[model samples]
Target: MLCPCRGKLKLLVVSLSFVILFTWLYLLVGNSENGRSLLLSACLVESTEARLLERDVLASRVREVEEENRQIRLQLSQSQGLAAQPVEGNYGNQQWVASADTGPEDAENTAEERANHSECSRSPTAEKCELIHVACVCAGHNASRDVVTLVKSILFHRRNPLHFHFITDTVANQILSTLFQSWMVPSVQVSFYDADELKSEVSWIPNKHYSGIYGLMKLTLTKALPSNLSKVIVLDTDITFATDIAELWAIFRKFTGNQKQVIGLVENQSDWYLGNLWKNHKPWPALGRGFNTGVILLYLERLRRIGWEQMWRLTAERELMSMLSTSLADQDIFNAFIKQNPVLVHQLPCFWNVQLSDHTRSEQCYTEVSDLKVIHWNSPKKLRVKNKHVEFFRNLYLTFLEYDGNLLRRELFGCPSQASSESTVLQHALEELDEDDQCYDFRRERIMVHRVHLYFLQYEYTPTDDGTDITLVAQLSMDRLQMLEAICKHWEGPISLALYMSDAEAQQFLRYAQASEVLKNRKNVGYHIVYKEGQFYPVNLVRNVALRNVNTPYVFLTDVDFLPMYGLYDYLRKSIVQLDMASTKKALVVPAFETLRYRLSFPKSKAELLSMLDMGTLYTFRYHVWTKGHAPTNYAKWRTATTPYKVEWEADFEPYVVVRRDCPEYDHRFVGFGWNKVSHIMELDAQEYDFIVLPNAFMIHMPHAPSFDISKFRSSPSYRYCLTTLKDEFHQDLSRKYGSAALKYLTAQRNI
Candidate 1:
């Protein structure tokens, strides 16, 4: 048993057991403080597997973005190429023929004075060429005609020597050159550039609405023009000049070198890009904002030195092109580049580029018949039948076209035959407009509610065959049950009341209903109380629920505080009976009036309310009148002469509209206060269901002290949150279902 090998093995086993036991004891004690902290540190660092997974996800995203970028670049590249050079038209090269005997020699002093004007001299570059360089793009025959008209307007207003740089096709270039040469004014020098020369450079730019190749011509102004020009004003073909070219040229002095405002432009004015582009993309510096490129002031040398073309190429390479949501081609490209470099642009006032989409005209540009410096007909030009504003601008454009060649004749002599003809045409157009004044009047006719007695009201009262078949729906709190009680007492015939309330209020109202004689045992009256716990007046939803509960064909949507005037029920019953099923499809809207707030007793009848109104004891608030509620354009006249008028698309709160259940139901999206019941009104309007406002019958709105706790709901967080959600949803839903018709009404209200 005492062999050498066996003794050695036994020693080794005992040594290993001792080592394992010691190691276990050390780990157990270390786990309390420093060891525990070390363990947490290890856990905090991501595991190898987790780290790998995260890296993989990030790599995938990069690849996706890269792929999208590559696709857009490919698209942009594919569109680049030179358009074929245009062929010359039938009009061959025609030499300059003087239409006026008076030459530049005769007006040399005047020309020199205008060229040396302070406005031109004050600019950084005062190289006197006696030229006001104005650049425009005219690619087609129609565009060439517009350019002629524009040039005439420019020349007629300014005595200063003018140089027109026209970017056009071969035919337009030839035609326009010939037309300008005929002007025979030595102060005017007309030059032309075939856009095809620059086509290879901007071939990558695709068409987007009006921003196609023609739109992109100004972007490449530096390379397309002679290097001697210091600054140039680029204009759209659709625009007409209202002020002199010299005034527009004066803006060059404001573009300082320190500011590095290489381009001067005005904001787009309309929220088109702001809503579509800016909202989707993150905003940049204060100066980096949306602008309309229709009118621009280009410092030619600065743009060339900046290597704008190279910067544009860099933008494409960086894959910034993918950020665009179509309809914003060149505009998006320009903005993206400017956003990266904010100092390159100077924001001009909105007047410089007066867009047709703008709701109002320029106050600055309103001098005599031509106050605005530039009129940009970007929109409202598509319609043949235009509003008065559009008509005026249209006539102005036509007048310029009519007097395109007459300006030279007038400069030599007195007012020529052409001038008289233009006046005649304008006078005729204006007279036609004068005859159609009512058609052009956009002012909303005000609604007036005059107090009148029951005898003044038109009452065709015959008892209904089915006695009291209408159901009245109201949402109420326990405190306002007395008003409901009053309505029940005064309203004749049978009307089932569907009251929406909270659980606690419902319990209290049920008790009151049991105690009251009018509500307790009357078989004709039904108290249908709907209760929800913790509900903060879901106005439309409650109305919808109540609407479903209604058993009768006709439903009256009213508030608890509404006390119907004398003979209302009788008149309503007879009116409902007289109408056929086809006529009953439309709602019967009875206008409601409010009594004095401090008055304890409600007006017993319309007669009493009228008497109080005349005696100056009670005043009708502004809200009591039956307005063209949330309408874009007023359709029907005010109901001064009419007893009842059908409104296709308007409704008010506590509207007293008796509609069939099948009509467009209340939109449940609307919540408290502001947009409360307007959704239902708009929906009914969109569905072509007319709401007839009844002057014959009305209801009294019994007033109380301003309830701060309740009225303040409009500004409350809950109300605002709900309102934002509902408003967006309402517009989207209507727009999706009914297109622009629904959108028109939804935007008209702007209830949110």
Candidate 2:
């Protein structure tokens, strides 16, 4: 009843009185706490909130009671689809995402009494228990990396795994089946969401690891819930917890006078501390807001009655709702709601729901061990940045939240204030997967790369001198040291080189590469060393290396083994010279590659191969390639083709020019044959960087040594074994990476 009408101070008391009366009426009508709160909101009143309060109160009470009873019957039969199923516009009682206007101070939005909402209420029954909802975002054993431990901990702490949830794709079957066979828990219901089944289909949310056709699945899960459920707790698989959420829920309930308030942590406003992204591609008031949507509790039936799901369909269709983008989709949408509808938003402390840390990622773990509620481990590589933030929170929970887990946590599902027997949301995401011929989750790019310019380098040697073209080519071809020089010479922006070392000299290289003037006025280059033993140094070492070198907003990585296809950037250029444009919205330009012509090794025996002189000169890399595939003809032939900065296929490159630094990027895993290059490319991990061959980009590979190392190529049994082992490992990794692509290219076309 305490409706603080901030807009017009004149009607404060009048609105308050009406709110009180409305609350009374809602109580008699058996309106849910959320329903009563919303019903009393003057924000939704268009014409006369006062008038409606005077007349509709008592009358609506009787109508609501009758509706409540009817809905209770439907609630009891939800499993039979009697209550969950929708009639026409929607086939299931779905929760539509709402889109409100930017009204007063973003804290208050213009709300109209929903006219299309199908009204429903429920009556309590003898059987009452807690229900938690979970979203199995991915099926491939959770790309987040902490899946097993997180899940196991939840099951151990909360005895009710069946009460958990599985909002995911079918491949999740691997884990879902494991859980099913392992436990005999009850109430484990699964709702396979087929996006194709929904009338409203464009996704308002994006599932990066899961199938793209999952928006409808969200609706399906919402539809599957029992009509009798008063509240639904939404959770992502990455989270873990220490606090008994019931207490948090209770707190949420207390602050929410007449409604069930949603609870969650707030995201940082600073762009740098936000999700992986810095900003959105499309220009608009940021979509999702400050809420860390990983956890939230909402009134299930109340949201369903308002047709929130349908609204989400409409909003997603018109607006961009992808949470993965610098937090554009899910997080952004939640942010929007809290900002626009402050009346419905229930702000919680940052402690409970924790996300991976950003700039502060290196800070402590467990926040004072006071009052912790949940935990989320994002990614292994990112753990250093994210895990400690959780620890910071966990520490706080253990210390101040006043929870005596020795006694509280001992009570099964009971932590601080909730009941026993443990409570975990059931996971059934494995049952829903999309296997269409085309991949909607990713957008494949088709590029045109042209062969640029090339010429014999100033230095040359003939095979007769051991200045022998065979040995010379073997050295120059495999040496990527020149890559740093080329990129620096041609590129006029930030250039990153993945070198093999990060020592004193390496630090000096970055200092110049990232200098403001060098990165701006001249050539901006940021070099990243590919450390053979990365652990010896801290990650901050690399970050500092980058910070000291390049000052440009954007940086490009170029491998030393690669060379610019002559005029590679000008293939599609309308003129010999043109204005350069920089942007994150699109690839500014793609690079065309070609190999630097080098001498070839033609040795016929292992003795002769290793016996050849100039281990420091012409044979600079010295036995790097001979270590893999030690066959007579092929090893000799393959060794001739080996290069340190080698790329497997066209897909393994980023658009770039030339640069040089004293970096040795010889990766053991990526060494030997063409195995290591794949690791380097995969390490980049940008979804957009997937190869798109540019018609103008083409490389004239300087053939490898054909005759110098012949002797070493043969009779090296141990070397052959190493080659075979590496090949097997490479193939397995390739298969894992390119799945279908590997099937289509590796074995299918034997003669290519």
Candidate 3:
């Protein structure tokens, strides 16, 4: 207070110091808050990463468990002895498991059974289940039948797995493929190689054999077959095995230590190789009596190692200089090769191949017919060969011919016992027959003929989600396949097509269908191939094939030539529901009509169809020519009825119907054109199935050239005679099978 200027300076300095202290305190608090936020953010990021890793691990485990469940389910199904239903979405590589029975008492045994089942269920190339490979060259329907007989004999006796490699033409391939596919034998697999692909290899060798160039296909086997095939047993279509083929397969072990031994063959049992069968028999050169090529065990690995192709070609070229052409084709060339390279052949016992050709001295090979391991009908006349023991061998062939191929699909464990029982039955049957009585007489006047159905390109269509679909079942030849697109489009539901054609036609049809815009993309059609085998058209057999394979609850049985009116498929579905058809034994008849004009626009509605009928452009199917065929439909009543109307069955009535899938099958015995459809209707009547005519549904038969059967019926007296005989026998059979019901129908027919 005494000095004013000094006091003021001191007070200002004190105020500046107080302001700096407060600012330092505020900066320290802000730094602490930022450090806490950084620590919290780091913890959250670490925690999130840990949860993500845990989720990934759980997802992986779930996937693994799912896979294990699938495997366990498959194994369990097999263990329960359930029918191996094909796994969906795996059509390219179908796997089938062998059935097994496991007991609760023995856990160890159960484990062993599981392991064995797993082994059996593995792919065809699995190591534990060694496959015995057999190859054959077969073409045409006749050849296909012969091959079936041959395979039947093998299946009847095989103890191990079998894989058949067939060199076949388009027809035989289709037939064999169809038959084998339907067979579904668990222990067997089949593969078909087109014979046309191999023709160029053997075509140049001039062959005068009765079988033509097809016989020469054997020479190309070394190149035709898979390179990985180490060994194979090649058999002729005409051969029948009397014992297990495994015994024949055992011959391959004999080739061991002998590097040159490439083939196991039986010596020829005839004097033809000795050049003594005829006065001017200039046979190909042979070592002694030569060797038969009918039953050959080829060491494919050894043959390839020795360059078999070059060797056979050289041999053929050398032999061709001396001879103009090979009379025996494959047999001649094979014998010539073996003659030059004798060390390459291991001679199989004569009983292994008891040849039954006309000139055969086969009695010297076997003491009795029972001693025969493989019977070879190496003659054009086949069963009528001039052998002294023709009846015994012929009967043996017939036994296999009449064998039910379905039996071959029985479980592997049951095969040996079943085969033994069958053999015993056959022996007893043969003993009871007279020596002069043929087991099967080709000339017998029989109504029913043994025909195979669904011989190729078999497919099963998936049902719609609602399961209220109708399957259109029909039969046709290749020429009629042109109508398939229209039929399929109009139906718009699943179509079960039974195609009857030769092998060449099948190939053509497959190619055409594949290239077609409509046919290729359609998955709703099931094309069941029935090979046109016999002279007369197997119309009923084809119909049955299409009829039997339908997966839907209802089926519309019609011919391929007949086009259903628009909305027929939808109408049938609605009618079935409205009429409660699933619970009834009634057939919904679709009235059929025909037109003489080759190219008429198909009517889309029933009114339009009736208009066409009124204009004389269309008439009831077989109206003037065979009124009896459609008269039972009662068309006059059908036109007036708003709802379905009942019609009394009449003789020779053959109206198309939409019936339950379980309806009486078309009698397959009434083959060809005339009586096929009528017999089916007669059986339906015998079974007491009600014939109800649908008011709206109709079928229009498109005019085409007459079928071969119709043409033959018009031209040949023998054909008509056969038809008459077949009809009589059919009537007798129907009377016997259906008893009083059939007799009543027959009485009504006679009165008519």
Candidate 4:
């Protein structure tokens, strides 16, 4: 509607406005991009500076640590010089000039020497000499004997000092601790790590191996061992060393200059990883023949630095997604990791770990049996494996089995008189064993190295002039541990307990005792663990262990189920003095009784027990079933006599007694349920020890189910026949040991 000139002006204005708006938008977008770029660059620069500062700080700290270590090494060298002078006896051995004796200076030097010696001895980080570190995982009772044999072999050939690291359960730790503590080997040290602490790390991984989670514990050594320990030699319990472990330790040198090699392992001797052992065998992924984990040289520091925990965990997780469960546990995981990262493993000579499995092809590894350095009994059948050379290997294993651990304490050098003589004897014995085919029948009766784990938990026994200072020596299986608290509370004296159980039961019992209010706090109780070796319960063996550990002058030898009368400890104290027991070979019998009820009010005095007896509430222990067991106590005379009454020993007499600490040890051959206690009484009688019945002292046997051996004796004809044969053999042994006169107390048709 406007004129032509006005419309042209409006169109021009509109175009100008559009151009300005577009230019403004371009400027705003360009500025935003530039700001973002500048901000990112600033951030990058700041991050780089922070990282550089952190690196510099770390370098400074490392330098500080290195300087400190150098200073420590310098000080240690000076201290060693001071310590060596007095030990060498050089100054005393040499004739010194009189002027060399500067009195005050000499005193100061001696004081400094003593100070350095004390510091070196007490310092945790002091390294006076090189120590070969060995790691082992022993989890159960079955492994106790095998591990002992392994340790024996290691000590037998070790020329240098050793420091053993044991990853163990409570039971195995207890057993190993007792053995090593008693050995007291100079320049040897041992440390224990609880296997339970590392269980969670590998417990989630499904394993079908017979060893359960224990088999996987080795996988966690890098995490379980101390951060200070950099290298270790891991061994299975069933291995025996033929040569010095120093030879095996030297293999670590081959891994040097090879950063990728962190673990040294012997190749698997069998075709286990070939996936051709059986039909449909889908073994885990592995290199040709894989490698054995039984003997591993672990570079712990390198492993940790390279994140070995994460690597193995990830590998296990990925493989588990495809497989149902691992067949060989940690060994499978190890092989799988090596297959993927072959550079991480350094293969050792097969002679180092000569696996002796049923399907073993390890014979090709060694030209002669002497070439084998380490023997691994990888099969469940042990010495009974199908190998043609089983006898030779069996003999070698038996040599360690029969080895005396005490001989290991002999000094290696310096003491020429005794140490050299004993060392020669040991060397000659070993040489003779090596020269002969010393393999004997596996079934032949022989002496075992029993009394292994003595006083796993010990009470310091302090003797008193009072007669109350008595120790109750008792034997029981783990299930019977429930009676411990009641007896300990009532007796008020020291107690030595011999527990016969498998490794698992011993662990369970330790846990149970820790949770117990009375037992955990008890300071007068000793626990000795006896591993269940054979099918039969070693009842006499358990008794001997308990008796041997009693430190009190008087020991009341009794069973765990029997609870002594109140004031019995005090009564025995007074009775010992009154009866002048110190000068006499006498055993004071504490007549034992039993009740049918599961729970009853225990008698506080002999009067109350007699009342219970007259009221038909209690009967003498095994009175109705086996009269001879307690008939020798002479209960009829005990009822009226205020003083002790002499009782003649009879066959099958087994009465609980308060005897001197030097009482005869029980016959270990009388195992299982029958004649174990009776044999002890027979031996006591043969030794001319008098049995006197205590009128006031008594013990009450609580009702419980019969033991497995007792049930077997009642149910199995073969068991009864074996017991009868053992009894006959025992009589013959007794006759041979004591004389024909020792058999005069035996009565024909006697109940046994």
Work out the TM-score per prediction: 0.36, 0.33, 0.47, 0.48
Best by lDDT, which number? 4
- Give the whole-model CA lDDT for all candidates, comma-separated: 0.55, 0.36, 0.73, 0.75
Q: In model 2, what is the error at residue 662, expressed in angstroms?
A: 59
Q: Which regions of candidate 1 are displaced past 4 Å?
A: 1-130, 257-259, 276-289, 316-320, 324-329, 358-371, 380-388, 409-752
Full ranking by lDDT = 4, 3, 1, 2
Of 1 and 2, the candidate ranking higher by lDDT:
1
- Model 1: weakest 10-residue lDDT segment is 81-90
Stretches of model 3 off by over 4 angstroms after superposition? 1-131, 134-178, 181-460, 465-467
Off by over 4 Å in 2: 1-136, 143-147, 159-162, 185-200, 204-221, 224-228, 248-252, 260-289, 317-327, 360-367, 378-380, 386-752
Q: Could you give candidate 2's per-residue lDDT for residues 1-752 as a string of tens digits?
A: 22122223334344445655665765664457765566565535656766567557766765765665555444333312212221111101222223344433231111111111112111112122344444444333332223333443444444332344554443344334433332333434343332233424434355442334432343444565556655556665556666544444443343335353333333332233234454543322332334555666555666677665665455444445433332333444445444444445544344445455444321222224443446544443333544434546445323322222112123333323332222232122212323351321111100101111011011111222211010000111213443445444443323333343322333344444345442334322223332222112122222223323332333233333444344433332321112121211222222322222364342333233334422431231213543221111122323333221222333322233211111122223322223333333332322223222232332222233442224333555644565445445555665686665554334522432
How far residue 323's Cα lies from its native spot in candidate 2, in Å, is 13
C-alpha lDDT (0 to 100) for residue 191 of candidate 2 = 39
How much lDDT does candidate 3 score? 0.73
Clashing pairs in 1: 79-203, 80-203, 80-204, 365-371, 365-372, 367-371
Instruction: Give the per-residue lDDT digits (tens) of candidate 1, residues 1-752.
Output: 01122234444455545545555555564457766566566557879798568657856765665565565444332211000100000011112222155573333222222222212222233323335788988775456645655666777667456678988876566556544543345455667888998988776755455546776666678888898887898887777776666766776766653446677776555555444444464321222236777788888888888888798667644644553332554565566666676567755545456677543333222233333457677774432433356677777666665552433433312212222333344445555544343312111100111110010101123334574366666655455778756777767645545455533444366567668876654444544443332224445555554566455667677777777776676777666766543354677876655666645455565566666767765544334433434231122232242455665554343255777756666664454455656667667677776677665666667766544435756466755664555567677888899877777755555753
